[model samples]
Target: MSRKTALLLLPGLAFLLVGFLAPAVAMLLAPPGESAGTVVSRFTEMLTDPYELRIIGRTVLLALIVTVVCVALGLPIAYLLARSTSRWGGVLLAIAIFPLLLSNVVRTFGWLVVLGANGAIGRALTASGLTDDPPQLLYTPLAIVLGLTQLFLPLAVISCYSAVAQIDPGLDDAARGLGAGRARTFWTVVFPLALPGVVVAATLVFAGSVTAYTTPYLLGGSSQRMLATQLFSYASVSVDWSAAAATALIMTILVFLVSGLSSLAARKAATS
Candidate 1:
């Protein structure tokens, strides 16, 4: 490459080296007095622990649930946003994306208030004779799912909306011209074309959900102990820096694996 091109890339390269790569290297190398082999052995032992395995399982399950729920809920809203020409489309898009602008702590706390025993939702349910007891909405798996879904819904909506908007309306029109119904055209043309976006959305949601700490920590109980929160507990509560580092490495690997698999599926779908 030319010197000018190399110069232009140098700033970004330096920033990544200092900001991202530096911290990752430090984390990997700075774990307590153990050698690399001992660190690997400790990690292996962690994997064999049933409690750790359960935490990993719950983390993966929660991430999958959040991804599925976000996609199912976001797809139609994205389609509407993509297809609408009304001035309100912009307004709706802004509303859909507004949550992403808020800090995750703020968003999770909002749900906490609403789902708490004396909160509006709980009161309304109790007043409406839905149940005799106020539901334990806070600090549950259900709460984690609800909070994470709300937190990640905007991502799915924006991804799907962008993909759907790129698709030519004429394609749908032509399918209709051939006597295909709305559902038929959408299933055959629109849905297939939008699969890339769906994959992107799912991948983003899964990654976010997997690494999410604040929401799960605030809204989840012992039963909902995800890997991120577990890492925090190790670092902060147990003061087990080595274990925390190992867990952090595992979480990073899992995120990359999930992203890589999603990318492969998207490419295959695009080609097929």
Candidate 2:
């Protein structure tokens, strides 16, 4: 390799080795002789636990739902931002980005106020006589999904907007000239071109959701335990560092698998 390239890579390599890799290795290594067996046993126990399995499944499900919702809601805004020539476009983009400036705790509390039993939605339902009482809006999977979606929607928007902005306007014009409608052109031309952004956005949201603790904990409640929460339980509450390491490794594997599949899908979409 070139000397300049090697020099450029040194800082990142050093940081990765010292900051992340060393700690990860320490976590995975149990002690001396018992490390291998202890690691295997911890993984086996975690795998066999029905409660843990449910948590894993629910985490994946919620992450997927959040990704989909973010794409659904963010794409149109992205498209508008990509296509707009007006002042309000920048204003709207700023508005969309405003939520991410707040801390996760602040955001979760905001959702709590909006989604609580006495919140606006519940009050509207009651005032309109839609029901006798406010439904359980907090501490549910839907609540977790909502919080996550709101939290990460900006990622999807920014990614998609950048991708959409890169597409040649001539393609859209050509598609339209060929008698394609607006929806048809987007499905055929714009969306396929923007698949890479969607993939990136989805992977980011998925990884974030998998590792997230605060939003899920506060919004979904103590009952809604994801692998992250479970890992915290093992490491902090139970003081089981080995089990926590195993759980962290497993979650890492899950994220890799999902990200790999997403990349594969994006490649296929690009080619086909």
TM-score to true structure, per model: 0.94, 0.93
The TM-score obtained by model 2 is 0.93
Instruction: List the RMSD of every prediction in angstroms.
Output: 1.6, 2.0
lDDT digits (tens) for residues 21-97 of candidate 2: 88777676663333757876878787899877898899989998998889988887898888888879889888878
Model 2 lDDT, full chain set: 0.86
Which ranges of candidate 1 are over 4 A from the true structure? 1-3, 32-34
Candidate 1, residues 1-272, lDDT tens digits: the string is: 99999999999999999999987867754676645665577688888999888888889998999999999988888988998989898999999999999999999899889999999888998899998788988989999999999999999999999999999999989999999998899889999999999999999999999999999999996667999999999889998878888788778888999999999999999999
Clashes of each: 0, 0
Compared with the true structure, all predictions reach lDDT values of 0.90, 0.86
